[model samples]
Target chain A: MNTYDLIIVGAGPGGSVAAKIAAEKGLKTVFFERGRKPGEKNSSGCGLGPRMFRDFPEMMKKLTPEKCHSMRAGVAARNYFVNKDDIVAGYIMARPTESVSYEPAKSWITMNVYRSEFDPWIAEFATDAGAELKTSTLIIDLLKENGKVSGVIDDKGEKYKAPIVIGADGAVSTVAQKSGLRSKWSQNQVTLTLQYDFQAPSEKIDDIMGDETLAVWWGSNFPASYQVFFNDGFHQGLGNWMTWWDKTPLFYLNRVVNLKYYQRLLKILDAKPRELQAHLLPWLDYPYNTYTDGIILIGDAGGFPCPLEAEGIYPAMVTGKIAAEVAAEAVSSGDFSKESLKKFDEGWKKTSIGEEFEAGAELWNIWKALPFSPKETMSWFVPMIMEILGGIFDWSQPHGKRVRQIISHVKSYMPKATPFIMKNVFPLVAKIFEDDLDKIMDPKKIMKVLPKLLDMLPQKKKRRGSQEK
Target chain B: MKIELEGLTKRIPGTGEFISINSLKCNNCDRCLFVCVMNLWRKKEGKIYLAEDYQSKCLECAACFQVCDAGAIMFKYPAGGTGIVIEKG
Candidate 1:
């Protein structure tokens, strides 16, 4: 029989989690994966963070680094902005702070894993919970009865029927489009990254990349280039929104590793390219719509990634659990109408899903604006920022003389900084946070910022620039 | 920018033919050439084309579909379990 009480498409974290819960609730559940296995289609090889641990403690505990074939990164990250001369202009090392209340903070931040290994481990939860998993099955269309999604049709000639279907299929969600609940992601809505996974011995990686497992390099020529250190290897790539792909992401990513600034890290990785992969990532806010009739969308299909970091797995799993709850509610009541299924939307909003999606709305918009927006003055401002910041510790004279020298040095960065402040930072701050623009621009506020602005000018600048007007 | 795909592994399934180009809609800007990770899209006599052996090499990331603004490219996942087998990522 191809019928289940609930059917979930795409057995990534979302579908698997939903299937697990649906089965536990005594619903005959089945989940399908289009790839040969669950993780084969998933990409990015991203780090799974503390949110997963906190949310699903029991589920996470079983999938240790050894069990899941994952690399644990003890270090958080150190960020850098590199200049034209292949030198660091500025750096901020984010040391993990000691936590007083948050328990997860006492532990590491992220566990880097190969998606090929990670996704299957999570799928085990569903199977263990008695949820049937069908691999190598692609849902090409939805089965509708009286204009409501009743089931799904796989790429094979088989059909699966259920009262409810959860679309956990990712960014190019065929389920979402076929159900008429959503459309294709526009260029601005999505971005893709191109990466080459470089291999090395596990011990070699442990020594070469210690506390700085994540080393980010931001230059004008490339979209934020970064290296993600794994147990035996690392993934290096850069990406920008589709709207910004004038040269294609492949072009920009290839240029990133070859740059003089990245040569140092490249030498240490000293490994050959093992796998070259590109994956589409969703950068959307909490979507306006998620459920309709017998259909509910979760994960990337629902566009549930956090805007700040595009973290999808947590949202996918969280939304999947919520969707399954709603599915159980619908199955028991024998009501799968659009109105009844509306609870899926209400359920997610009341949880961290709402907070994450709503919070990152602004940051994601700013990121999208980076490449295509005409106001991008980063071309000039970054070089200037590098010179000022990169020279911050230089001291050839007495402490007093060095202090005075730094002041004069900051003067050159102002003209270029002015436009960037006005164009990008200032407006984003005013528009996103404060209700009243005038209050944010009040002279008191301006005074706090203007002293530095005034320092970028001539004569007695150091002393006069410090005092309030 | 040198692209080395010599180490790439893909399991072809039944002569995969999921991506197609609509030549009538082709503006010939040729963004497809560089965007392809596998470099499967080739240009012959100034017309962009794909080789018959593309199934063996294509990773099916559809970077070309994402970049083609002129509506000339049609892309779909090959038959289930029929495309790139990502072992590392």
Candidate 2:
């Protein structure tokens, strides 16, 4: 019988952040993790943006040379045909400054850390902030009283009571289900992903991936997915997403995109494929109510992953912080009702985190509609944008000039280039580039719907029939 | 090598050292067959059969193990040291 002000389940990024924030706010917080350690069961590409660290400056302060790993930089995109004949729109030899340099082009700044190291660091931050952390404990069920969650019940039948229960559990969340917050997710809402980590010599990695660029291959003869090359110290990690096998048969799909295909791509790049490990990931899209009476679901459990990029770490952290903020306020007021916890959603909406998911969903739908031809997607946009940004205008300039140039380019090109642009460029720009650009330029109105754009597609049906049942 | 079983054992499909083929639950999806790194399983008689060629090549990376939702594929650590032995990449 252990009681606390807040009990956070699943010590992933979301759980740790909630625990840390709650403990820092002087609330009695207990965090439970099923893994042997914080990140043991976690796997991700480590493509986290700098803003994640900017928000949680304490995590960065705790990062040590041994704990942190860095990639100098790498190429961003590669385009190869399904026939394996020609790499028409390849970008393996691009410079770091070409894409994301203005933000901070630290050669060794972008790191590829094993979640084994990274997750524990965040968990330790929670413990250091005075939150009690229990590992090797699986939270099997929720303890409810009068239709309100009061605590958690673990596998060993041990019960711990808390005024607020935060479910930071990953995609397959038991807490969310037991709380009657959301139903089983449909296959369409989940993206089945597979990633591989390989061990290769540093020289080999540098030779193949180039000294300064993470390579992202698209529209290759391979699956409609993205592949990343990370040079983290001694290991060169490669991760890719696979199409949903439940929708398509794996053997037919695998024959099309297997080790042979990967080997051929590596050979083209003059890189050798090594010891590989792959795992599946489930990503959510539809919004499920995340808060209820005395309980809040954060992170993947809340379906908070960015649908387009499939990035979850930053959003998980942001949502975790918001949940903790609401939990703290509720605890202080001696009220753990659903009305008080509604602030979690309100606070999350106020931040860019909520906008990221909403925009990401829209972007995902647009991407799904577009053709998966890498040559068609990149040839028109990449070179055109590169010429405009690199050849025409200098990136190192006042923000206003850059904005004016882009606006003028769009305005000038609209009349003559509308058809071609709409056919090819609109999908990529609208889906990936627009929201991110809007976030940077005007945070106030980050979501910008292209007029008459959505109407172009048939109206999507409501969640009916099998989707809901 | 074919061996006959008695009673309940006859009712159950023989389990291999590395693979546990639950012929009943398998939907012939071939997810296990395709996702296998070692190319172990194949379709025959509308069911997946573990290939002898895969005995030496199984890396034990467990990609097949994780992807198979049908519980048709299972891997136990090969007796001591008989699977994929990696030197480098």
Top of the candidates by DockQ: 1
Best candidate, TM-score = 1
Using lDDT as the measure, the top candidate is 1
Span of ten consecutive residues with least summed lDDT in model 1 chain A: A369-378
Return the lDDT, model 1, position A152: 90
Alpha-carbon lDDT of model 2: 0.59
Per-residue lDDT of candidate 2, residues A92-200 (tens digit): 3444454554333333334455566678777888999999999867787899888778899876689999878998977667687788886445545554443434445
Residue pairs in collision within model 1: A293-A338
Off by over 4 Å in 2: A69-89, A92-110, A207-210, A229-286, A370-469, B1-89
Model 1: how large is the Cα RMSD against the reference? Answer: 4.0
